[model samples]
Target chain A: MLRSPRAIPYLLLLPSIVVIAAVVLVPVLVSLWSSFTPYNLTRPATLFTFVGWRNYQRLFANADFWWAFGRTLVFVTVALNLELVFGLALALLVNRVTTGRKTIRTIMMFPMMFSPILVGFQFKYVFNDSVGILNNALFSLGLITRPIPWLVNGALANFSILAAEIWMSTSIFAILLLSGLLALPQDPIEAAKVDGCNPVQVFRHITLPFLMPFIYIAMTIRSLDVARAYDMVRIMTNGGPAGRTELLWTLIARVGYQNSQMGMANAMGYVSILTSIAFTFYFYRKLSLSRRYMGGAE
Target chain B: MAEVHLSKVVKRYGALEIVHGIDLDIAHNEFVVLVGPSGCGKSTTLRMIAGLEEISGGTISIGDRVVNSLPPRARNISMVFQNYALYPHMTVRENLGFGLKIARQSPAVIEQRVNEAADILGLSPLMDRLPANLSGGQRQRVAMGRAIVRNPDVFLFDEPLSNLDAKLRGQMRVEIKKLHQRVKTTVVYVTHDQVEAMTLADRIVIMRDGHIEQVGTPIDLFERPVNTFVAGFIGSPPMNQLEAMIGSRPAGPVAVLADGTELPLPPEFAGRVTADQAVIVGFRPENLYPAGHGIPAAGQTLDMDRTVSLSEPLGTETMLFLDFGGREVQAKMLNPRLVAPGERMPFKLDLGHLHVFDRASGKSLRA
Candidate 1:
């Protein structure tokens, strides 16, 4: 059977197919099945007991779960948008630099080089209320007599986490957008200049439209990455100080692992998957639309 | 309309100079073509006049205004680039009107100008189509329409028809000439094709090695080139040049070839040549023709019998190659008949249309 020409392609793909089935499809199916049962990790025999819609019904009624879901939505939105704006600015500025560009580009990628866990630790030390570098610097300047509680307050903690996430991920957007800027043809820009466009008008009319596809692509990748903002958030606050900064990921982790409530957590996980899908679908549609507008391959 | 004048203009990149100091004057509403081979500073000179490149030394003035400091927009000149440069994202109508929109023109004026240019370029049918959706010729028309809508002081074309196919290029050449006639603006065009220069220019400026070799009307350059370079550069198949020594014969002065073939010099250069003076004898292919199959000569002629090495029929005429003084020389036959190789035929060289150049300087020795 393997000697046939039509079977050769499937034969070559056999290893990857087997690995994907074992690692991805099997685990996903198991979790999906477990979401319908009251499967506790401590009692493995309870995995067979079915409790259809019970975990989902409780998740809908739980106000803490809704608050975490809403907070996660806000976090992903704010982080992705701010990252896009700052990244575009960085790409444009670096593109204008004619000299020592390689050195500057390498330096620009420094933030993206550090792992998210390390970034979380670094920001945690920076935002510590009593002894952080930010408050200490403010004290040395005589600007503040007392330490500001950066990571303790409700709104300030969210802002601190946002700042850390933005710092760690904005370079992703910049690098991608910079590649787009580099590939842009110089003829259109020169033509715009000769057509009586000022620099601002040139950017607004020519440069920005040409960069739309790249912006959408960056937004798509960053949105999916930001929707799963768990490691850094867990390291920084651990959903602490009366759960002011409780996001869906931390909430689900606490319920699924710490409390050994795997069924409820799997239900939450299934619902959160909707947000990632929605974001990916929306951005891909926008990417294709912008690409079509630029007369690129659809 | 504005007349463009450049006085000793120079261009330098860092410490290396590319365009040496050169002077040229283009009259108002005249079509002047700057033509040369590749890397000959023709495009660079056009860019300098368009204010796209800064001149290192000397001044460029358009209509008595020294526009050295002004940007391309303030210069009020429109240029069609070689690549068309149509905005890929914009429709044809928007691409045509973008300049006026940027200048803060109102909707009515912009629409009027855009529609007028679109009608002129036959782009009204493709107004809503993006550049990528249009064919190559249509894109080129949009580029021209974009330049025309501005109604600029002068029109600069930088090899604008180079991207088109042969048929489209020929069509665009005629269209450009018609455009100049209808618009009547000062036009400065650049191309490397001598045929384009000959057909389109009122006066053609030939450049080589960053220097202006000659500036004349097409017919003037064709009839009396200042040097061998222009003679070879401006004609189809190029003029044939032979190295010879001037010798005194009993009848008059003759150019003696290496193989001892003596051809009578033109009457105008009778007093210019001395015995044993080395010179280059030049004549166009039409002047060297088969003996009985050419235009009736009005002056002295030199006849030779040579074997035809090759013959190329060009529909209206045939180009015959034969050995003359040990080198291949091309001769034309009008109302041509097929003549095979190794056939001996009599050829005539018209001394009335002969060109003599100094061997060392390559400059025409014509009075």
Candidate 2:
């Protein structure tokens, strides 16, 4: 005989799907539709009038958009790589410890618990041009003779934001890599020693390769996280001084939310989404290759 | 190859001592097995010798030098873990060659050595495969291969066969024996399986509660146990013990069971007795045979009225579980015709092969 019908399962799933569609899917579709039109939030009637490729054309010629695009790429690339380096160092240090390890691990996760907005505000005040803690401390110590223009200089402003991003996100990498380190088999390390391997060699050949999958996983996750790096950048510089630190998000926010040019902003948003997909795909490919290199699959 | 010695070696984790001071001298190229129940210090002792653990007191010497301060690399010992801790991310070839590569060996030398190990282990065809791709037995072989490629002075195994299935354990046990015979390295193996200890050890060290109770040839401990613990832990199906009191003192010293039946103690043991001292009488399951075979030729004998409780039949032998007085005892018979459960069969206790222990100290009454 056929089984009895089960409406309860479908009923249970319906509410969640409705909520997700309302909160997530609707916004995405509405934005996609708005990208093809000359829709401005101030003029609601323009939602139905399609403007072909004019918004995309404006973006293609816009110097501000191109610069912001380049700056965003540099920011993500430098921040992610630096975070990986610092994270790997921290994980190795923690892994070498013999006592009070649990306490150390919990403490390392403190930076990750703070909101990005809070981190930005904290660092912003610390690096303020005239009255900042860093300048004041340097001046009092007779270290720097002048008050350095930290947030005003174009290059220094961008570098400061990059440094803040690295500091805020490095712990994620360390925690993930530390778990990989802990799960490693003790046998291979012992065998390496019996085989007459020194510590550095063991780390390079055994430890590093074993940790590859974890590193790539961290990279993939952080690429997505950094692609959406908005709050910190907004609080610190706001694409500042002369648009020197103007990343894609700040540019898009100004266009879409502040200026209410919803259509042009949606076009920029779609273009920026491609950048995230590209980074994710790159790291995902690296992860699979590492696994294959380890002979997990033929 | 070298001899290993643990002279009063001890291990303590804070206030709890896992291995008391143990003194053992393993001869060159000797195959020594440490066997005991769980919570015994057998594995801890092996780990100490391997330099994986620090000696809390005393000294451990590989060959003739004290290795207390040496790191595992300097100790020149390889360990085969119970789980066969092969690196899951590396191919067999990579895993085997990793140590050599780390030492910066010449590429050609590393290749030749890895190939030789692969050939010896019969892992050539699977050299490019990862650990996940191999079977349990293959993984175990690779673990052995990893150890062998180093050609260290001592081979330490920590219950290596414990992770295998029964059939696989038996097969690997023979393979290990053959490997030892071929390579002739000094081996310190630890296991709780008496059968493994019996079949492989040149000398067996039996331990209990962080102290070695006895160390001897397998037959030495089996035939002349130093205490009740060694007597009970050595033999298969275990030795049977019963509480008894001294009686029938005029003609000979005899033991009276709970049922008031009488059995004579061995003539050699009669001198060590008093009438009121409590004692535990011990005998192996195989030492008690069917009564028609008559009593053993030497020493005293006892005939018991036992209620047969269970019968376990094997191709070459049968085990009879029978209750004597108030306690159960196991008796083994050679290829017996047929015996059913609950049968009242007479059995002879070979008293010359029996053991007696002081109940208070669990120490043997006589050698």
TM-score of chain B of each: 0.98, 0.94
Winning model by lDDT: 1
- Each candidate's TM vs. the true structure? 0.95, 0.90
Instruction: Tell me the lDDT of candidate 1.
Output: 0.91
- TM-score for chain A of every candidate model? 0.93, 0.91
Model 1 per-residue lDDT tens digits across residues A192-259 = 88899878988998888899999999988888788878888888998876888899889999999999
For B182-228, candidate 1 gives per-residue lDDT tens digits of 98999999999999999999999999989999999999999999999
Q: What tens digits encode model 2's per-residue C-alpha lDDT throughout A229-262?
A: 8899899999898898898989999999899999
lDDT of 1 at B58: 95
Predicted model with the maximum DockQ = 1
Per candidate, native contacts kept equal 0.52, 0.46
In model 1, how large is the Cα lDDT of residue A64? 96
